[model samples]
Target: MARDPFATADLEIVGQVTTASNVTLVCGADGVRVVYKPVRGERPLWDFPDGTLAGREVASYLVSDALGWGLIPETILRDGPVGPGMVQRWIEQVRQPVGRPELVDLCPVGEIPEGFREVLRALDGGGRPVSLIHADDPRLRRMAVLDVLLNNADRKGGHALDGADGRVYGVDHGICLHTEPKLRTVLWGWAGEPVEDELLSDITLFVKALPGELGDRLAELITDTEIDALETRGRALLDNPVLPLPQGTRPIPWPAF
Candidate 1:
């Protein structure tokens, strides 16, 4: 993919972001928080592949939209030292610890509070539901579930940020949405459990709503095979069963607070 080049002046670097190489949280001209990746004369992973990352970012963004609000970021723009880096919505940090911090500390669920059962129960399953488990606010669950499916290897406690604005956010896509099950996550204990009905219904609706133009737009970044896989996964999520969770299990990541 051809990278869209931009000058450094294009973004407003805000704070420091470690874990990944050459990353700096920056606000773009559009006033969106984006992690700036600098591509220079170096290896693909080390320097930056420019458009490749941007394109992948776009694909993830598209899938998030399909899943509902759970997967959200502002948009991917071609603004970086060498080319277009990923741009995303900044979720405000959750100020209070809503659940038990100990359980999360023992395990790891992307910064999710332990004993969040009550909070999960209170959510609404998006009315435009699917067959399997889903959440009332499809958007929030979308992000959490996709983070699991994508196997965002970096979805550690801190990465699973609490956007104080009534939402959650996931970041660091350096390792996500792979071909394999690669499901190394904090939410694994919940596997084989019953998915929420309302959430499943939402997934079905979300898939049917996929736009045609998006196919073409995504073609520029990922392969036809990747797109097809995502579709298949969406179906699988919809068809998933709703088994009651086993003892000592968690469907999503526990906050590693």
Candidate 2:
């Protein structure tokens, strides 16, 4: 097989991704657009092992590919302009429709239209009931499923985006694949709903492929123990395919947007 362009291309840092911990850029070449996250630039977190976020990001991509969710953009671990890090293909988001006030902000609880699921409710600065809604989009539903499989610890509202092709693309997965159950996300719309047949089928296939190539790929980015935990989660989901109820007192990320 021909080598992947993302791994072989000469990377150049065109700019910095401010919201990200250690993210940067690769001057796009050969139609390859990517965001680079160097290990050296990673901010250390107490809960996670030091200097492993980049690897975790790559592992997230492997899991996404294995599940055939395509929720994550193409990502790989390679030498970048700064050093070795995770390089992910940049997703060009489609312009969000205007005139939809709720599309980007917290709408009043009473104003939310029917069909939208309320994921968050809080008192705004004015002491009014501010509610956050999750759109009933198929792509978003798929992303929610992917997050559960990865045991994603951060799925803020902003992490999910509408790609140019009308598909949902999820990013910022540097803190996933924890050995413990740490699924915190803003996609509580289907909190108690059973997993769809199509999604379950995908998870089934992923479990079947895990003992071989997929497992090998993940081993390169995470510990053997972490991989085992991932498989355990997959099998459990296969047995009871439902969106896991929120764990811990606080299940949603703060500043949800």
Candidate 3:
């Protein structure tokens, strides 16, 4: 059997992501820069079992790849310096021009940008009124749909990246693909809107592939119950073909960015 270079390359830790909840290390795997999240470093959550987050991250990448969305960077579960972990290609964000609104951002109430949709209206730390908004971008719309399928529990604003390669990527998918519905995210801009025909078609193909190769791959990363839930979500999306509105009190994660 051949070994995957991304999984077999020697990793050299370059830095640590202090802001991350888990022990995230920035490393150079041979010449490839990547983010390494060792399972031993995962913080135990009440809902998810310990040592499972890394696999979930890899599972999210597999689904994203299957959808042909490229919404997530290339990721693999492999042995790193600390032990087995999730290793994902590092995405260098492209810097936006000054005064340009980000993919997700805050704008003054009533002054929402033309291509943006307001998700929330609230006061800033300075007591100034502002609206939480995201761009009406097809790339982002695809990501929102992916999040729905994965039942992504946390999609913070910081997780969406505008890559230097001119693509949007989502990261930090450690808490996803649970059997329970846990679709918290910052992308409610297209809530209740009918999904575009092309995206739906892609999803149609994804659902069909679920019981075959994709299912087998996901079974290795997540439980059978989670895979079944994923299929159910995909079928539901196809039946409705509409972006869901925020549900429950905490549809969006706290400290969104």
Candidate 4:
């Protein structure tokens, strides 16, 4: 079998992402920074199938690319040091702790700020009130739209980043593309707002190309039923073309960061 560009690259581990379920390594490959998530290192999750999160990560990049939104960084499924897995461009951004001082900027709740959206609220360890807030930047808004289409189940405040290129990028998509409607996120700021004409046009294109183009590629990574669900979600987004109202008992992820 022919190898992808990343398949045989020399990878040196730079660091480890401890919070991730899988052993995620920040690696330097041919002088380029990339994150490598090996399939063999993945710990099983109850909701998701075993050893398939890497595929889901790659699938997310494919969807973002197909949509022409560039919401996700460049990602490829290839061999790593341990085994075949997912490798994605490492986004460089100033790191901020999840809660505490940056919490208001990254995620806010109650008496929302002028330019932020209150996605959800929660109580801290001491039963203090906290709200999840996301910036109202248009780039983030587009990411929100992408999350909806992906049926993203984990869109924490920390997953969205302000990249060095001045673009908003979303990470940690291993739980996406589910057959069910699982659109949890910290991006409810645009709920009830009309989707911009430009974004709507992109969504239209994605809907048209999904089944024949993107669908074939995603089938290799996820289930056929997931592909079907993806199309269903895309069509639903097109039909409404608006930020949706939150549904179900839990519309936001825990520790929203």
lDDT of each: 0.50, 0.81, 0.92, 0.81
TM-score, one value per model: 0.65, 0.92, 0.96, 0.88
Pick by lDDT: which candidate is best?
3
Instruction: Report the C-alpha lDDT of model 1 over 196-222, residue by residue, as the tens digit.
Output: 776677667756654466666666766
Clashing residue pairs in candidate 4 are 107-133, 108-132, 108-133, 109-131
lDDT of candidate 4 at residue 256, scale 0 to 100: 74
- As for model 4, its CA RMSD to the true structure in angstroms is 3.3
| Per-residue alpha-carbon lDDT of candidate 3 for residues 56-164, written as tens digits (9 for 90 to 100) | 9999999999989999999998899999999999999989899899999999999998999899999999999999999888899899999999999999999999999
Question: Candidate 3 — which residues are off by over 4 angstroms?
Answer: 1-5
Q: Give the TM-score of candidate 3.
A: 0.96
Better of 1 and 2 by TM-score: 2
Candidate 4 lDDT by residue in tens digits, 84-143 = 888999898855555433322432335666667666677666777777676778988888
Which prediction has more favorable lDDT, 1 or 2?
2
| Candidate 2 backbone collisions, by pair | none
